[model samples]
Target: MGVYSEGFLEAVDAALADFEVEIRQLGAAASDAQILAAIERVVLALNSVSQGVAGGVIDTDEREQLCLFIDEVMTENGIEVGELAARHGVSRYAITDRWRRW
Candidate 1:
């Protein structure tokens, strides 16, 4: 089994739920394998969204909301500030500064 936390799993589930309708629509015409592949892509895209937010690739009004979601998930999972900073190639202070404003 994977070592994902409850918070992380919940986040993934929520993200997937957002696409449930579309996925079901595709399932109507697609083969089972194709449907599965589409679901996998959705998961991958959701994962990329988080990475993009962390690496500062996203630049829109929604960025702050996405950042806050990421922060909440990380906090719930007990991820250290320094670890998140290192993952994003940023400083620990930068992470704390953003959190402080939230």
Candidate 2:
């Protein structure tokens, strides 16, 4: 089990931005495998950020619910904090700080 925090959304958003850029670069290569690889890379990036955030918090069913909520928010906004942070070249702590404001 794992908990999701606002930080999670931030992390995903940051990763998404990077992923989009990566997809574009791969798109220029014009290969299906390259595009798929780029997508997988984005997923891995997001997974890495989520693992980091989850590791910092408690591990339990309650935490999983929280993470679900975070995913919902990210979906609505079509962005993620981690991805945004990466786009801006900032630290996760900085992304967490932004969440603290909320």
Candidate 3:
């Protein structure tokens, strides 16, 4: 009954975990640029984690998952959006703007 296979979901989860690890390693003093770059990498990885997932097919649930993942990462890493934007001129909400396919 799932839109995606369990294996594909697991891979996506792993990709998120990898991004979380990167954020944890970056710690409290990480520059916005650094965090944004990591976000870009994970967005790309998520966009490509499974075949037949491209061409503007990001479903509602998938989008929610992505947003939650990104927000949770920022929260867990103590990333303040206004501060990060001031630091690097990049909005935290815009992390997927430059990298996500859908």
Candidate 4:
């Protein structure tokens, strides 16, 4: 089982929301798949946001990679993950269970 701290999850959620808003602004329709895809893209974009936080223009690819990396880090940190997973409309167990497939 992987873990994720509350703070980290909050940051990720905030970042994901930002990413979703941007995608919608780009003219993507409001569908289940589109929403999900937009979220994934935004998570990927988290790397860029992290970089930009340190003074950069936000490389989109970097953001994606950073998010993936963060999840691993969260697991290593031993923070109880899955609580925030429910926000995505899935069970906390499912979110933390083999979540990489998402």
TM-score of each: 0.32, 0.42, 0.77, 0.31
Stretches of candidate 4 above 4 Å error? 28-45, 48-102
Indicate the TM-score of model 4: 0.31
Give a tens-digit lDDT track for model 3, residues 1-102: 236666677777898889989989997788767887888888888778744443334565777678677877778778775576556665656657677765
lDDT of each: 0.47, 0.49, 0.73, 0.46
lDDT score, residue 41, model 2? Answer: 57
Worst 10 residues of 1 by lDDT: 93-102
> What's the residue-level lDDT of 48 in candidate 2?
69
Best lDDT goes to which candidate? Answer: 3
Candidate 2 lDDT for residue 32: 41
C-alpha displacement of 45 in model 1, angstroms? 1.9
Model 1 has an lDDT value of 0.47
Clashing residue pairs found in predicted model 3: none
lDDT of 2 by residue, 1-102 (tens): 434567776776686677556654544434444543544455566556646665333334533444454434333444444554466566423433233212
C-alpha positional error of residue 90 in candidate 4 after TM-score superposition, expressed in Å: 30
- Candidate with maximal TM-score: 3
Candidates arranged by lDDT, highest first: 3, 2, 1, 4
| Tens-digit lDDT string for candidate 1 (3-101) | 444555555556655555445454344453443354345446555654533332333444455445544444443445456467657664454333222
